[model samples]
Target: MIDPQQATPRPDAPAVEDPATMPFPLISDISAARWLLVFIIAAAIYFFHGFLVPVLAATIIAFASWPLSRSVQRALGIDRTATAALFVLVIVLFLVVPVTMALLYAFRELQQWIYWVFEVNANGAATPLWMVDLPQIGDWIDEQWMRHIGRPGAIADLVQLTSGNTIASIYRSVLAAGNVAFHLALNLLFMLIALFVFYRDGDKIAGQIDIIGARILPRRWERLSRVVPLTISATVTGMTLIAMGEGVILGIAYWIAGVPSPVTLGVITGIMALIPGGAPLCFTLVSIYLVASGSPLAGVLLFLWGAIELFIVDKTIRPVLVGGPVKMPFLPTFFGLVGGVKTMGIVGLFVGPVLMALLVAIWREWLREIRTHPQTP
Candidate 1:
């Protein structure tokens, strides 16, 4: 039997020795080497981020379509693989086909215009009246047109210069198209792969995200992850629908006004719909063409159509589609559309507003946190 003073110590009793005062175990050389290897691997990934951008973009695209894919799967009682395939097919038809056709048509028109100019120069005819009446540079254009087309020697020189410039421009455009195709191919491949993985194991992915969030912020990460994807999807869908509506309206107007190349103009109008102040350019050019071709009545009618369409579409249709879904102020939305187009080309128009929305959401969340938990004195 133990004496009362020497009774067994309770398991829950605090240790007499202080952890702070204890000597730490030395790290073994092998363990240190292993840690260094891990650090090096992480550094390599960080440094080569450029190579991973396409993959990241693919992941984002996959995530953005996840809800739609899931919805389709549920509604049709189809497997995830079939749903992903259908989604990709729809993207190809709606997005890829239109863009490809537009580029091709634009290039062909440019080439035809250049050929016409050269042919007119060779025949010693007056320059086209439309070129002579271009805004802001009409006088300068007239002077150059006379010098290049009215005189034989000058026409030869002008032809050579124009041909060289045309060739150079075409070459550059082709190179750009090649680059675009390469990047697009990579993105498409990776996106398909990502979509397959996402569809196959969506719940697993969500579980991983939750685990990561629990390990990291423990409060805000999960919320942000959900919010960001939803915001992006809403913004993209709204903008696409609005732009399509505008395109249809403008295309119908162009056709009604008997505009030559109405389809081409419609395509341009659709593309410009992605920009804040670009639609006016198409309308102005079409109007000028009408007036110079001696159809003042048609020109006036088209100009009016353009103005009415723009006002009605922006006030009624656009607000309903984009503004309603994103809950963004009109002024901010307008600026974001313009600024994004200017900075990031076509894609930025959608990206910019979404980014702004996300920022606003984060700020509001932070403000709420601060209000709820006031600092101690």
Candidate 2:
């Protein structure tokens, strides 16, 4: 009886809402389940705070080495577990073993230095010719040395910082060393275990994270995810290569300048070069030693060489290796390094750059979005 085209729904019929036209709810309308989930997440984070450092370190290491891990796994046609075991073994053999040996050698050197200090303090000695002959500051240094280190029992006073008790101070120092060693061992163990797990299941873990990331940040996840690993790989590789180059180059210079223990000094300088200003401090101290010890020309030359090399590396090499891929600027890289060291200690060196890279990526993303959808005033 009615025209079908003009027919209208009955008044009592249920209405169907169009999802695309639905307005977002206000914050006040958030559900209790979401609040409960957030609380649970916060509680978990609070509880697992202690594992943060080692876990983060492992994560960074895993991310950096993932490509190499994949290549090795594919080449060998091995299962992930075997590949992971081999990876851990390689790290232990190449990194841990060498570091342990270096630490032991350094401890031995420290022991000898301490013994010499004790002997010097027990029996006063004449000022060294080099100290006496040093230009301008020579006399001042000689006088200070005679007062502090050249006199008998002066070293005892230096160690009496805690409650002015020499024995107590030494006891506390030993206790502190043991505590540090224990904690270090635990961290290393946790890191290795975490590394193995990460190596074995990194792909699956990454996939799970991608799923979550998509759900949380549907628009930006792909770009942000790609940026992190590239940034980490670039930063770490750049720093390490620069450090090794500096060490090798400076070690040769040390030898040419007749510096004692050139190899050891090179190793030390290389290690120090990881931190900003560290390499300069090492070379500057050594150069001063050379000048004080009657090789002023060599010292001056060494200082000049170090300055030039540092300038070249900083200006030319670092930007290409570290910043080229991420499209990051030098200032951010420098701040990241300094800030990371300030807040996170050594690990921050890598983490800091990564955070900055993410910031840059997000900024660019926002810019793109703005360009794509300019708002009408």
Give Cα-based local distance difference scores for all models.
Answer: 0.68, 0.78
Model 2 regions more than 4 Å off? 1-30, 120-126, 153-171, 174-176, 244-268, 295-377
lDDT of 2 at 86: 98
- TM-score leader: 2
Q: Which candidate is the best by lDDT?
A: 2
Residues 1-377, candidate 1, lDDT per residue (tens digit)? 77999898999998798889977769877799989989998999999654454444444556667777888889999887787678767867886577667656766766666665556655666667777776788789788877866654465566458775544465467557767667656655665566567666777888897897877788778777777776666655555456656666777787888886676677678766655556777887888788877788888888898888878766776566545534556566667667755764445545566566566667777788789987999
Instruction: Please provide TM-scores, in order, for all candidate models, with all chains considered together.
Output: 0.64, 0.70
Q: Write the per-residue lDDT of candidate 2 for residues 145-206, one digit (tens) a residue.
A: 88777889776776675357784456457447657667666767888999999999998999
For model 1, the superposed segments whose C-alpha errors exceed 4 Å read 1-65, 113-127, 130-176, 179-183, 248-252, 255-267, 304-377
Listed per candidate, the RMSD to the true structure in angstroms reads: 7.6, 7.7
RMSD of 2: 7.7
